[model samples]
Target: MYISYKPLWHTLIERNMRKEDLRLAAGLTTNMIANMGKGKHISMETLTKICETLNCDISDVIELERE
Candidate 1:
C-alpha cells in the first residue's frame, strides 16, 4: 500500500498556510518538503513535527492508498 498526503495539502489550504510556511513552522528542510510532495517516505520524527505544528493527528495528514 502507498501513503497519500492529500489531506495534509487540503489542510494547508484550509489553514491558509503555504508549503514554505509549513516548512518553517515545522522546522523541516526543503528536502523533507520535497519528499512529502512526491509522496516519499520520511521519518516519523518529521511527521510528528508537522502534526505538532498543525495541531493535528497523523490521520489528518496521511491515509492509506486504496489498492
Candidate 2:
C-alpha cells in the first residue's frame, strides 16, 4: 500500500494557506516543507506539530492507499 497526500493538499487550499504559510505556521523549515511536498517520510513529532498548528487530524493531512 502507498500513502497519498492529495487530500491534505485540498485541505490546505480550502484553508487558504500556501505551502510557505503552512511552514511558518507549523514552525517548520523550508527543507521540511519541501520534503513533505515530495511525499517523503516525516517524523511523528513533526506531524503532530503540523496537526496542532492546522487544527486538524492526521487523517486530514495524510492517507493510506493500496498500491
Per-residue lDDT value at 50 in model 1: 94
- Note the clash tally of each candidate: 0, 0
Each candidate's lDDT (Cα)?
0.94, 0.85
Model 1 agreement with the true structure over 1-67: per-residue lDDT tens digits? 8999999999999999999999999999999999999999989999899999999999989999976
TM-score of each: 0.95, 0.90
Q: Which model scores highest in TM-score?
A: 1
Cand. 2 TM to true fold: 0.90
Error of 2 at 61 (Å): 0.3
Model 2 worst lDDT run, 10 consecutive residues: 1-10
Judged by lDDT against the true structure, how good is candidate 2? 0.85
Clashes of 2: 0
